[model samples]
Target: MKRIVITGTSRGIGFEMVQLFAQQDCEILALSRNPKPVQELNLSNVTALPFDLASTKDLENVESFLKENWSSVDILINNAGKLVNKPFTEITAEELFSVYQTNAVGTFQLTQKVVPMMKSDGHVVSISTMGGVQGSLKFPGLSAYSSSKAAIITLTELLAEEYKESGPSFNVLALGAVKTEMLAEAFPGYEPPTTAREMASYIANFAQTGAQFYNGKLLQVSNSTP
Candidate 1:
């Protein structure tokens, strides 16, 4: 069985991914801020780790735990993120920092810690946003959110290059506007968007074959695949 580790598994895309992978008979090590209900999923191979991503120090503990338990991870999915809808001028420095803390720094740190623990031919999927792509608009007050995600995209590209000869491969998925609570919170009056289940399936399929097509490329959900 393939061993995988994913972050932000409490809700939205993260939750759906945990469910989908469990069905595929993969062993999952999922992380989230909340501890409750993850146990309710009742998958024998599922382990939900509760911790705040903002705490960079927590990554050390996470790494220690993984080292003590699992031998190596076949897949590492960086799915945790944070978004704020304040206008560029209205958003405080702290708010902007918060966005980067979870979306970029947390991902960077977690990925850094996991790279050495990955098995040969392993894969890493960084969940990004279409908003990160060039020409992707910044409606009203999404400057911080867009910028942070953009940073993640660049980080993904850099990883692809830095680890080219390494055993594992890296890719970034620039997801289109998905119908998750994050979308609802960002655009409250907007109509329903893509379902988490569909996105989850897409991500699962991508995890399986995406590295073959995109090593450093950005795979936009709407245009890259169906």
Candidate 2:
């Protein structure tokens, strides 16, 4: 069975992705701040680990946890993230740091820890935002969140190249607005965005194939009918 590690499994896209992978019979190391209450999803192959990514100490714990449990992981999905809606001028230093700490620093630190445990030919999928791309939109009061996502895009590209010859791989999924907590915070009263299941399915497909073409690439997902 393919072993996979996914962050942020408590809710949103991360939860959906964990469910999808579990359905596919993958060995899952699911990370969340809180334990899920779904008895149906409770399975032998699934192991849920709880840790607040915001804590620097937690990063060290993550490294130790993986080493102690699974000797290797087949895929590492950086799905856990934070979002804050504050105007650029109104954003405080603490708020900005909090966002970056969770969305970028925390994600990178986890990746660094798990990368070594990834099996040969494994893949790393980093969940990013379309807002990271230039011209995506400078949504008012979302400067901090948007800029942090942009940094994730850069991190993905650089890591992909750095580990180009390594067995494990890397890619960034620059997802559009999804009906996630992050989106709700940014666009209150807006209609529901794309469902987590849809995004999860697309990510699952990418993970199964090990498609190197997407390596180091920023993939965008939209709800526009083709």
Candidate 3:
């Protein structure tokens, strides 16, 4: 069975991913700020871990858990993210830092810790936003969120090159607006064309197979034009 590690498994796309991967018979290491949602799923193959990606203590907990339970990971999904929707003029440094802490720094630190435990041919997939793409349609009030996701995109590319000969592959999935709590908060009442479950299905399949054929690419997953 494949050993998969995923962050932000508390709700939204992360929660849906847990459901999809569980059905596929993969052993799941699910991390989230609150473990309740993942635990409630009650899949025997799933291990629910509570860790706030922005907190160093929590990140350390994740590292310790991996050390105790698993020797290597086949797939690592960095899906935890924070979105701060504020006008660029009013955005505070703290707000931008918070988003970066979860979306970029946390991912970098966790990936570094997990790489040593990744099997040869292991895959690292990070969920980025279409807003992060340089030429994609830009939206107001997402300055901090988009920039942080952009950092993940760049980081993934650099890591892919750094690890090219080591066997593990790194890729970014630049997702379009998906109907989730985060989107609702970012753009209230606006319905997105894609749903969390749909994105989860696509991401789960890619996590399992895409690395074999693609690396260091920011593949966009969306049906809507933008």
Candidate 4:
């Protein structure tokens, strides 16, 4: 069975993706700050662990799990994200740093820890917001969240270049208007067309096969009209 690691698995897309992957013939490591949701699922091949992208201790927890239970990881889904909605002046350094800590630095560290355990054919799929895409439509009150996510886009390209010959590809998906808790928090009263389960279905498939055809690329996933 393929060994997979997915972050942000407590709820929303991450949680739904866990359910989707659990149906497949693979072992899943579901990481979230609140691991109880996933643990309750009690899937035979899924292990739920309390994880915080901003915490060094949580990173070590995942590493320890990998070193003990699995020989290699076939997929690493960087799906966890932190969002802060506020005016530029209202946003504090601490808020910005916290965003970057989870969305960028923590992701970088975790990927570094997992890459060595992955085969050349493994895949790293990072989730980003459409707002993070350069030249894309900008939104209000997401300065910290959007910019932090942008970092992963560039990081994905860099990692793909560095590991082109070694195998295991890196790519990012910049999503738009998904009906998620984070979306509601960022844009109140806005109704997104895409549902969490819908997005998870697509991401679940891509995480498994996208590496074969793509690497070091960013795919903007959106269906918003006008």
Q: Give per-residue CA lDDT, model 1, range 116-210, as digits (tens).
A: 98865888999988778888654767788878889988898898898888757888888877778898888886655578888988898788777
**Residue-wise lDDT of candidate 4 within 1-226, one digit each (tens)?**
8889999999999999999998996899999999999999989899999998888888898899999999999999999999999998999989989999999999999999999999999999999999999999998788899999999999999999999999789999999999999998998889989999999999999998898899999999999821
Q: Arrange candidates by TM-score, descending.
A: 4, 3, 1, 2
> Model 4: how far is 35 from its true place, Å?
0.1
Identify the superior model by lDDT, candidate 3 or candidate 4: 4
Candidate 3 Cα lDDT to native: 0.91
How far residue 194's Cα lies from its native spot in candidate 2, in Å, is 1.9
Q: What is each predicted model's overall lDDT from 0 to 1?
A: 0.83, 0.79, 0.91, 0.93
Q: Which residues of candidate 2, in runs, are more than 4 Å off?
A: 37-40, 224-226
Screening candidate 1 with a backbone cut-off below 3 angstroms (N, C-alpha, C), the clashing residue pairs are: none
Query: What lDDT is reached at residue 216 by model 3?
Result: 91
Model 3 residue 17 CA deviation (Å) reads 0.6
Residue 34 of model 3: what lDDT? 93
- Model 4's alpha-carbon lDDT is 0.93
Where in model 4 is the C-alpha error above 4 Å? none
User: How big is the positional error of residue 3 in model 2, measured in Å on the Cα after superposition?
Assistant: 1.0
Ordered list by lDDT, greatest first = 4, 3, 1, 2
lDDT winner: 4
Q: How far is candidate 3 from the true structure (C-alpha RMSD, Å)?
A: 1.1
Better of 1 and 2 by lDDT: 1
